[model samples]
Target: MKISDNCYVEIHFTLNNEDNEVVDSSLGGEPLPYIHGMKNIIPGLEQALEGRVAGDKFSVTIKPELGYGERDEDKVSIIDAESFAGFDQIEEGLLCQIEGEDGSPQLVTITHIDEEEGEVTIDANHPFAGQILNFSVEVMQVRSATEAELRDGLTG
Candidate 1:
């Protein structure tokens, strides 16, 4: 069946950066599945997958805005180093999860550690933000979404 709203789709995809570095892939793993037009995946990828059928293959490039949103300087901030006391050590470029303003867990990358001042700088932007995404994808399956799947925004 062709992919359409609420249709369950399974796709094998390899995602790369503008530099051609593989950012992620489902080549050897199980195909990734999602409910079409439900925002289960990025807007660009989902839009590109629309109307495709099983066995279809295509490539697409997504701008940062459509991918992860442009990196925001406001998303970078410094907090008490004590927040990471649970860790044996904290260093630059380390990814961790911290509570966001709404009390939800948010992923952040440690960009700097000031041991002398007890401050840790973190960037809350998604690691993929502000970057172009190049994807090579193959449709593995396309079928009507089950009642439960549609309601739950997932697939079996």
Candidate 2:
């Protein structure tokens, strides 16, 4: 079956950056599966995979805009330590959630901690933001997606 908006696809892929560093991979392991046109993957990759059939192998480079999006300077902020009042210990590299402006939840990583100043630097941008992506993928399986799956816009 050809991959389309309501089809399920299984693919094994390796992603590398311009630096040739492996950003992610599924080659030496199980293939990742998802529904086509369902935002299961990056926009660039999904668009490239559309209309392809099982057994197809291809490579594509995704610009930052269609990937994780360009980094925003405003996404980084420093907050006083008192904001994390309930935490007994605070350190860098810790993942935490904060309320966004619209009352939605936002995840951020602790990037820096200043003990004397009692402040923490948190970055809300995605880790891969502002970088291009190079992907090599091989389609392993293709199947028609169920109506429920299509409505949910994701794979089971």
Candidate 3:
């Protein structure tokens, strides 16, 4: 069947960056499965897969906005190290959760650390932000979604 909203899709995909570096791929593993219209994948990819059926193979280039989105300078900020007092380790490239202004938990990556200055630079932007992405995809299977799968927005 053709892929459409609420359908279950299995695809083998290789995602690459502008430098042609493979960012992710399912070629060495099992095909990834997801509910077609539940935002399980990036917007550009999901749109490209629409109406495609099993055995379709294609490549798509997705701009930053349709991928991880443009990076916002405001999302990179320096805060007092005391904010993370309880944590034993405070180093660059560390992923941590912090309470946002809205009181919701937000994931942030530690970009820099100044032990003497007692400050930490945190970036809330996605790691792939501001970059174009290329995707090579092959549709392996397409089937009607089971009621449970649709309700859970996933497949077994």
Best by TM-score: 1
How well is each residue in 10-45 modelled by candidate 3, as lDDT tens digits? 999999999999988999899999899899988989
Q: lDDT of each prediction vs. the true structure?
A: 0.92, 0.88, 0.93
TM-score on alpha carbons, each prediction: 0.93, 0.85, 0.88
What clash count goes with each model?
0, 0, 0
lDDT string for model 2 (1-156, tens) is: 788887888999999998989979998888998988768888999999988988999999999999999999899999988888888777898888877779999998889999899899999988778998999999999999888877765533
Ten residues in sequence with the least summed lDDT for candidate 3: 147-156
Query: What is candidate 1's lDDT per residue for 1-156, written digit by digit as tens?
Result: 889998989999999999999989999999999899889899999989988999999999999988999999999999999899799878899998888989999999999988899999999999999999999999999999899998766633
Better of 1 and 2 by lDDT: 1
Best by lDDT: 3
Relative to the true structure, candidate 1 has a C-alpha RMSD (angstroms) of 1.5
Ordered from best to worst lDDT, the candidate numbers read 3, 1, 2
Model 1, residue 137: what's the lDDT?
98
